[model samples]
Target chain A: NAGVTQTPKFRILKIGQSMTLQCAQDMNHNYMYWYRQDPGMGLKLIYYSVGAGITDKGEVPNGYNVSRSTTEDFPLRLELAAPSQTSVYFCASSYSGARGSSGNTIYFGEGSWLTVV
Target chain B: AQRVTQPEKLLSVFKGAPVELKCNYSYSGSPELFWYVQYSRQRLQLLLRHISRESIKGFTADLNKGETSFHLKKPFAQEEDSAMYYCALSGRGGDDKIIFGKGTRLHILP
Candidate 1:
């Protein structure tokens, strides 16, 4: 079902440039999230949405923005790329919150490696 | 002010030996705990959650509210178990925000 898909598996952006990381899930999930993975810092939540047309900031959301126009898509936008943003980004989704047993488990994308030079 | 800590960055265990990956969390209220594993060049996936109280791939973790720990353990380690393991936590109820630990790379040596 392509669980979760991310575009541009790898990308390099010039300093001060802007780019968007596209993420889509075919499982019809209601909750979607964007996370950045560094070498020693596990995964920091950038932004997340509970449903379509609803978005909220996460742990590390200062340099990024997000929009969830639909239930299947949650795109992360980097307005001004910086060298500090150079890391692996992952998109994930879950059917709901921590209510159920199995359905709430999150599914992740293959991850996009971004290098800001 | 919620945080998940995985004290070890890397752990090596001989084949058929017992294995344990320590995890401790800090949260004021009840929290949901999870263990995620990422294989080489693969997406991160859920290995187990504390709510389910079930074991997956021979791995089990018991939530200790008193100690605020949810450590993953396996009776016998296998080479196939080599992967990066992350401990995660989330607030109770509708809060889907899950924070993850730095992760521990488990190396099963033969």
Candidate 2:
């Protein structure tokens, strides 16, 4: 399977511009997440969803928004993009929470590198 | 707040030498710890979990509750083992939200 798929492997947005990072999973995962990876730093959670229509904030959710409208899709929206948002964004999914019922397996899509100028 | 700490940013070891990556976590309750690795240009993937007490790719990690540490070790390092490693922590039960360390870039010298 394609597993988790992310779009626009690379993008450069002008300051104040808006864009969306699309993510999808064919495994019918109930949990989805968005994370940003900065150079020399760990991946920071931006937003995550437990299931459809359920979204929660993560450590760094200031400039990002996410919606899990369907089990297969969780798209991250960037409004009024800023330079600080420049980083490699990763989208991941799991059947359940990492240590929860389903299992501790998380499948990740190829990261999307965003640069804000 | 849950936190995962990896003190080293880069670690270089000669081929066939022993290697260890240190990780410490701060959590009040029983936690689920994990090791994630990313090879050059490859997607990040799980290496092992503390709960399973299993070994992967000749690497193993033992979770020490008293010390709040889970260090990944390999008796003999290989060039293929060179990659970025991250230690992670998650809340008990199914709270998929995990906290990750800054990550350590491992370099296996030939």
Candidate 3:
């Protein structure tokens, strides 16, 4: 089974442009997250969803919007891309319903590289 | 505020040498720590967790509550071990968010 899948492995956007980064997981996980990694910086959470129809803002959610319409999908939208938005984005998922041990391990996708000019 | 710290930005060692990646964390309550690794052209994946205390790929991490540290160690490093390693921490109970460190790039030369 494909654990997690992300589309548009690479993309280039002009300033003020908008685009969506799609994320899908086949594991039926309850928790999904979007994170962006800049040079020499750790991953910063952009947005997250506990389950379908529920989404929340994360540490670096500015200029980004997220929606969780289905169990398998949670997409992140960049309203107006800026040079600062250029970075690598990753999507992750974890099963929260399970007991303590299994719930904390997060699985990440290959990542999407976005370049804003 | 909860945070994770990895002081070393880069670490290099010769193949077959011992390796250690240090991680320190700050949190009010009990925390769950984890080590994640990313190899070239590969997705970031969980290497180990403090809760599990299990070793994978000859790599192991120990959580020292007294020191507020969770350091990853391997007796013998291999060329394949070269990658970026991150230390992460999540609080107990209802806290689902995970805080990650800047990460350390480990390079094992032959």
Candidate 4:
């Protein structure tokens, strides 16, 4: 059972290069999130989606973008990549009831290691 | 704004020793705290949450509103328990996003 899947488990890019980190879930979860983990910064939220066609910015969404056109897919796009973007990115999903009234536990995917040289 | 603070960046304990990982948060809404663990070369996963008031893998956490802390504790730590621990806080509502603190790397020595 694939809980949450992220593509390009490892990647390297030059400064200013752009790429999209693909993320998808098979659990029919309504909430999806993208976060970046740095050495001392912990995990910083980049973007999130509540459901199909609904997306919002998180704590650190400056150089990143995300789309939720369907329930099963929520991809994060990074434009004009920079050195600070070199960190492990994680995609997570949770199935809270309507308005997230229940089951707030989030499931995380094996992270995508990206290095912006 | 919400914030999670994990004081210790690295913790070393002997096998079978009682271990405690400190965690503090600053949030005004009803607090929803959780402890996440990541073993060496493994993905991050949830260990326990205060709302459940339950123990997992011999670890438990209690939410203290007055102190604004949710520390993870284990009476007898095993070598297998050596992993990175993170403390997190949820927004007011359940579905709201979560804020995580810098993780603490726990090393259980023999």
Candidate 5:
């Protein structure tokens, strides 16, 4: 299985430009999340969805948007990109039906590198 | 508010030496803790979680609720043990949103 897959592993955009980071998972996980990792800082949640058709803002969701159109796909949208938005983006998913009971490990995708100039 | 902290930004140790990656968290209620590791040029993966109470890749982490810490430790550090490690925390029964620490980069010398 492909597990978690992300597209356009590397991208560069001008300031104020917009783009979408596509993510898909075959594990059929109910919880999906988008996170950004800076140089020294760890992953910061941008947005998340429990399942298809439901989404919520995360700790650092100011400049991004997300949609859970299907159980396998959850894409992140960057509007008016800024230098501050340049970072490695990771998409993750997990089966949460048995949360706090089982391993419930979160599987992450091979991150996408985004640079804003 | 829930927060995770890894005080060290970088740590270097020689091969066959003991290794410890410090991690601490703050949460009022019982929170699920996890250790995620990212090797050079590789995607991040789960090393272990407190609930599972299992050791992975010769690494083990124990949750100390009294100190709010879940430090990762290994007896004999190996060259392959070098990587970036992150400590994460999640609430008990919500959407399972996790908060990650700043992460520690462990480098093993030959």
Candidate 6:
């Protein structure tokens, strides 16, 4: 099964343009997240959803929006793209539970590279 | 505020040599720590966690509460071990979101 799938592996957008980064998971996980990684920087949480119909903002949620309509899909939308938005975006999913000894291992997609010019 | 830090931006070692990637974190309460690795052209995946207290792929990490460090170590570096490693932390209460460090790029010379 495809653990997690992200579309538009690479995209280039002009300033002020808007686009959606699609994410889907087949694991039926209850938690999904969107993160962006900049050069020499760690992944910063953009948005997250605990379950369908529930979403919340994370550390770096500015200029982004997310909606969890179903168990399989959680997409991130950029209202107005800027140079600051250029980075590698990753979609991840994890099961919500007691988090065993290994803790919750979040599965990530291959990542979507977005370049805003 | 909760934060994770990977001091080294890049680390290089020869095959069969021991390696260590330094990581330090700051959190007031008990925190869950994790190590995530990204191989060439692949998605980032979990390597190990402090809670597991187990080794994976010949690599191990120990959390030192006094020093607030969770450094990753491997006895013998392998060519296949070359990758980017990130240190992350999760808070016990409040928002259970994970925070990651800048990451260290480890390169093993064959």
lDDT minimum window of 10 residues, candidate 1 chain B: B90-99
Interface RMSD, per-candidate values to 1 decimal? 2.0, 2.6, 2.0, 2.9, 2.0, 2.2
Measured against the true two-chain complex, the DockQ scores of the candidates, in the order shown, are 0.62, 0.58, 0.56, 0.49, 0.59, 0.55
At residue A4, candidate 1 shows an lDDT of: 95
Q: What is the lDDT of residue B27 in candidate 1?
A: 93
Question: What's the CA error at residue A87 for candidate 6, in Å?
Answer: 2.0
Q: Model 1 over residues A70-114: C-alpha lDDT tens digits?
A: 899999999899999999999998876547657468889999999
Candidate 1 vs candidate 3: the TM-score winner is 3
- Complex DockQ, candidate 2: 0.58
Q: What is the C-alpha lDDT profile of model 6 across A1-117, one tens digit per residue?
A: 789999999999999999999999998888899999886556778899988999998889999999999999999999889999999999998776547654566889999999999
DockQ score for candidate 6: 0.55
| Per-model TM values vs. the true structure | 0.89, 0.91, 0.91, 0.88, 0.91, 0.87
Which candidate, 2 or 4, would have the higher DockQ against the true structure?
2
Candidate lDDT scores, in order, read: 0.90, 0.89, 0.90, 0.87, 0.90, 0.90
Identify the candidate with maximal DockQ.
Answer: 1
TM-score of chain B of 4: 0.96
**Candidate 1's DockQ:** 0.62
The DockQ score of candidate 5 comes to 0.59
lDDT computed for candidate 2: 0.89
State how far residue A72 of model 4 sits from its true place (Å): 1.7
Residue A24, model 2, lDDT: 95
Candidate 6 chain B superposition, TM-score: 0.98
Docking class of 1: medium
lDDT of 6 by residue, B20-77 (tens): 9999999999998899999876789999989989999999999999999999999999
